[model samples]
Target: MRKLPAGRAGVAPAPLPEESASRPLHSVSGTPSPLPPAPRELTVRALVMGGLIGSVLAVTNVYMGLKTGLWESGCVLSSLLAFGGLSVLARRGAPPSPLETNLAQTTAVSVGAMPASAGLLGAVPALTLLGTQPPGWAVALWGVGLGTLGVLFAFSLRRRLLEEEALPFPTGAAAAELISTLHSTGSAYAARARGLWTSGLVSGVLTWLRDASQLVPPVSLLPAAMRVGGMGPETLSLGMAWNPMLLGIGVLVGLQAGLSILLGSLVAWLGLAPWLVREGVATGATPDALRESLAAWLLWPGVGLMVGAAATSIASQVRALPAVLADLRGLARYGEGWEATASRWVARAVLPVILLTGAMGWFAFHLSPLYFLLALVLAVPLCAVCARATGQTDIAPISPVGQFAQGAFGMLAPPLPSLNASAGAVVSGAASHASGSLWSLQAGRLLGTSASRQLLVQLSGLLLGAAVALPTYHLLVSVHGLDSQALPVPTGRQFKAVAELLTARGLEGLPRSSTLATGVAFALGVVLSAAARGRLARLLPSAAAMGLGFLLPASYAVTLCLGTLLAALVGRLRPSTTQTVQSAGAGAIVGESLVGVFVSALSLMRQG
Candidate 1:
């Protein structure tokens, strides 16, 4: 067996040979190692770890949804912190095998859905609006059902997406780096875990205070009209706000992306929104109404154009698919052999356990079994298509497949109540998330971990997430009255309102400033792609997405962008420390979000 450089743990020192490298490290040696053991009290430990981390994730998810109208990033960021911290702490006694590292990375990232999977909370407003709430068993069953559905959907797509089409699992990459660094440096996981806990707690407290009252002060200093001035007859606007975490996101995204997002916001708020307001097409002061009106007139066309560009660009890369698939096939065959030979059975056991858990969830919950089955079936094809569409031929499109499966389920079940739809949405979120976890696992596979062990750890985290998060959702909803018709959670309300407006207004011959902005931004992105060339250009889509995020509200965008810039500046100043800086920033985001969620949960607990 080829050995990596001494003391350089967690890093993939070099890509392994075609056959031997692809097999699990333990399996290749023909020595059956016992299952890779976790702490003695593994189940209890996992639950405790999950509960703490899950609580934090829940809060951050809600805060982000309420604050920026996005939930994915916050969840992703929090999961990174949890897993990264764990990996860092685990390095003390014996270096975690690649399998263990992969497991931890996968588990942490998988558990990230805590916030977005607000099962019952999501159903509450819609149920109330419809004047119905399911029985407790029904709700629990729903949670189990949707969670199972998500697993099935994610699993079906896993092979094709994770193995064949190499997607840029960005968050996974970050997690891998953290794990590698900690092990290499011989650091204790306990210290890192403590850091995560402390940071998370602080973040949670601050976020809670901000949401609880007016004491934090609104970040927007500009009046509505001033922000909306210029950019045609539409209402264009901007504002300045303070949010450390969002700012960090902006910085990490970089100036170009941040600026692009700002431009998107300018088009929507400054140009289109004001026009609608003045024309009496929308009511001022109602951001949700404005967003819907703008989305109707501008957002869809912009989305179409962007999709067109991505499709065109990606189609050019389709020739690489065959090669990528061959690579994955080779890995799968090798992995099978490793499982047969390796004694480290724990990791190998993960695949079956995950599958079993998913099946159990399906039966326990009353979701349509067909949807769950279909999700699995469609995953590979969808991932392949998305990979082809996005020109990411080297990286498997596992994440996209997961996302599409969930999205498809949601679409199919749309007429159902919000809670049910939310369940579907959770499926999508979790599946999309699994893509990243799979990516981490693949990374470990390259570095000599057994596939079975990696799979086990990842599943451990996923189950942990489900176990802790569902209750947290109920607690938050009950305490905060999120399910109340009078005070629906911000994101759900916004989504509902937008859907309503689209239904009422229809999409025809409407003025679309956001669409125009998107058009211009996309053109600019293409130029950026040309200028950046190679690896840099790969970030174009993310940059464009960031721009779109920014174009929402100036105050929000500005703060986020600034935070991102600060992080970037640190990266530039200490080029060698980019990963650490990123980890710290991500930790802060998770911390703040967790604090907010815990507070909300606590409030609910107290009220109950």
Candidate 2:
């Protein structure tokens, strides 16, 4: 599984243009496919394993996203784990085939993405913050509908993105490489597999000690009373979070993104927040409530920056749309009727899902018929942009899709937060699932697996993921609530802040200083995002990441930045061990997250 990088929601970097052309898939042993073609791709065992892995990941994602605003699509992880587990059973007459692995991976990734696709981690939580709670089943159905819509879109664009243009979806490519390596004779996977499980075990044990057993005390880098110029470190929220997942995400996202968050955190916590409190523009009744109080003011500018940055990134991605559309036209000839080929089946699957989504939106979310329908319509183009961007950079701009939808409905809808938020959810969910599906599809294509079978596996995983995601969300929310410090829900808070900002009577409801800060932040976001698309792209900070820094606890930024530096140091000092670090980091995230969910469930049961 890969977490969303900094600025991932919408401000993913522009695609690299000067890449090599497509080539045939080969094993790490420098040979064509080592495994023979499978008699079946979508076996019952594959579906079961996919669903199991996906369901676990769906729970983990909800916990991770709400706690840290970082979520992953578990394609690579699923591939590795499935291969390792199934290969053991291979000696009993059932061989572990690459195509079957692809099917399992597809199903797992689909299921893993359900939390984001269903808006459980963001939009739904934002709605809850605003006091609107849809029933759990409704949310699950809504997620399923959106996920299905995305899968259909992925099928439509597979030919254009994968078969024709041959964009390198790096994450998918990694999964393919893993499959190939696993299937190769005298494989090098044993070392990696060991590192993965070992790190996972250590992290899980630590999480248990810290959260469940309570034997380990919280670690703070600064004393609460450590002061500079009449301000204390505690007041500024300057501390590092001691969590394995933060370290893992930092390693994955790298230095630039970590520095970007640090930059934003310094600005918000040290600069803007202090000034606001000093000038009485922001207030809290007690010292304990100060951070929360300040966040209410900070998120406006943070969300503004995110929106601006996303807009710029989306604009840059738009240039590829014309070419993508032109290539898509080549799918079916003019002579083909509605019932002629695969396009007909796609249409049949798509139309009813679309209608079902619309119906669900109306009955469950109180979405306006015209507004929500428009959101679904807009998702088509936005999903195209997301697909192209992901293929190019392995970052799906799902947040940007929702941010765009929010902006559109903010103006068109009747200033209702629910209406606009639901619209955003519809668009974001569809785009997220679509991009996720493409990653799976990309892996399938490289392995020469059956696309149709992969599609079915994805749909099956979607249903299972939806079932798992909603209940897990409720469980976490029931234990932590939306406002608890344990689960800061930065993305959800951002969504809530944006909904309120869009619904506000212009700038009338905000402090004058806050309005000014928001304007400056928005402009800076746009300029920074534009700069990131140019020659200094690698050197510059991500505007969206900086914006997230403002929304998250300063400790999160500090810890994640430290992790980034740690990863960099490891890479420079011991290059050969870099992959080991990566595997350990990924394991840590999975380990801690799984334990975190288990602890949450235990806490919930105790409360009952």
Candidate 3:
């Protein structure tokens, strides 16, 4: 066994048996498993894997947003399921090769962004309504715009964030733990697969029932407070409602992260939302407005916190970058067979294809060429930052860079009127998401998978998913009247609030107490983060954030916080088995999301 440097708490990087040296990183057990050799070429199998996993990711995200008013966390859950399942599968008789594992892990992580990507389809309807036919170039440009810009922006910071810092890629760490444990027993793959399918089915069914109005109770039980005197009327809130799926998310997120989200929600729902409703600044405190409100409040502070935290955290991980890059370069030089060259050629081919597709999208969407160009420029740096933040420097410069480029363009110069700069903000949020995926890919690499092959498969999956998702979104909208104005697409309560600010007659108003309160909350987060230690320190920001979320609506934040607290309790109680518990909780999240999507799709089919 290679004696590596001691890690945190003197724990060495997980040991791999010498016999497994020839196997890919994912199959490091070195056992004589009968897994198939990694595919040298892009094939039907790879594409199907990406597509199926991407779909699950999409469902998970949709359900997460619906259940807990958070979208980014879904990516974390999807990564866990995909990698965890593959790890377990690789241990069984039909174990996956290292390349296969890499492909699966990469594709799954990339696919996690599908829902957000597909959301771009809304541009079409909005443009059509404006009586303008967006050309293919416009649509393609939009893609190139966000993809390039987001990458650039992320990349500029990669050295500082990913290379220099060792921010805990919490989700990634969780995924790696699961993969390692599963590989140990060889049965982890089967268990993960079971979890994936089960979650998908459960989520799908719930979504369908809710859509069809068969499960109205879930939506109706809004937390409300009655006013006894004439000071005010009764108020309805969505602070801490319960659903099986959101609870699962809470469990996976544990207390720290979950609490932060809940705190954010509370500040918006309980504090700001009520004021907005009473002052007629917004419509009543309905469930629809809850997410928007929270988003609006979180925009600057949340982004600031995320960026600061990520930058600071990733600074610690930068030391690993040189070795990672050297490894890649070494592979390029020594692995000079046709297969290696083939992978290189594939990457080359994919770049132009992505560029061409992006160009076409820009024209089709009638996007501004300037915005597209800027996005392209920005994508490089943004990806670097994301890589640094997530501790997955290798994958950061690729998928996320591209996606961010597209998102940045779409947001900055979206074809639709309703889709504004905030769209760019939302796309910028992709850095956090891409960071999570980077961790998954890193796990694959650690297990000895080829980086080049993983890149190819993941890119292929993203393209396929984009193709299907665009049309699927259109069909759903046309048949079901699923307009953003109604369903809100990517813009939730936060976007609505921003829109209100734009449309409001006079936005040059004085500051309110809520603003002060928000500032105080942010300061509290920083202080708590500094003062706390170990798990408490790690969790302080999230806890403070959750407290703020709870103040939004006692009911919603309360339930969510409680759920998170329960999970944290579990972690504390069973530190050795935290990953297993987290996996189960993540499984539940996957189940709820998958079933919800299934139900939505079924309902749509039945309607058709």
TM-score, one value per model? 0.65, 0.90, 0.65
Kindly list the per-residue Cα lDDT of model 1 for residues 381-444, writing each as its tens digit.
4444443332232233222233233335545554443324333333334334444445444454
What's the lDDT for residue 173 in model 1? 43
- Which scores better on TM-score, 2 or 3? 2
Q: lDDT score of model 3?
A: 0.44
Model 1: worst 10 consecutive residues (lDDT sum):
391-400
Q: List the residue pairs that clash in candidate 2.
A: 9-399, 9-400
Q: Write one digit per residue (lDDT tens) for candidate 3, span 1-608.
A: 12111242222243233333466444567665554433332344444555676666655554454333344433334444444555454465454333443456556656555444433422333334334454433442343334332222222232233234444444444444444444455565555556445644664455456555566444334324543111121233433343456556676555666667666665555555556655644442554464445344444343223223333333444565565444333433323444357435543453564465445544453334455446434533454445654453222322222333433444445344343332333244335334544554444434444444554554455554444444444444444443232233323332332332333311332124344443454465445544553556653554334433532334545565666787778778977555455555666666655554555566677777
Question: For candidate 2, which ten residues in a row score worst on lDDT?
Answer: 11-20
Number of colliding residue pairs in each model: 57, 2, 124
Report, for every candidate in turn, its global Cα lDDT versus the true structure.
0.45, 0.78, 0.44
Candidate scoring better on lDDT of 1 and 2: 2
Best by TM-score: 2
Of candidate 3, the 10-residue stretch with the lowest lDDT total is: 1-10
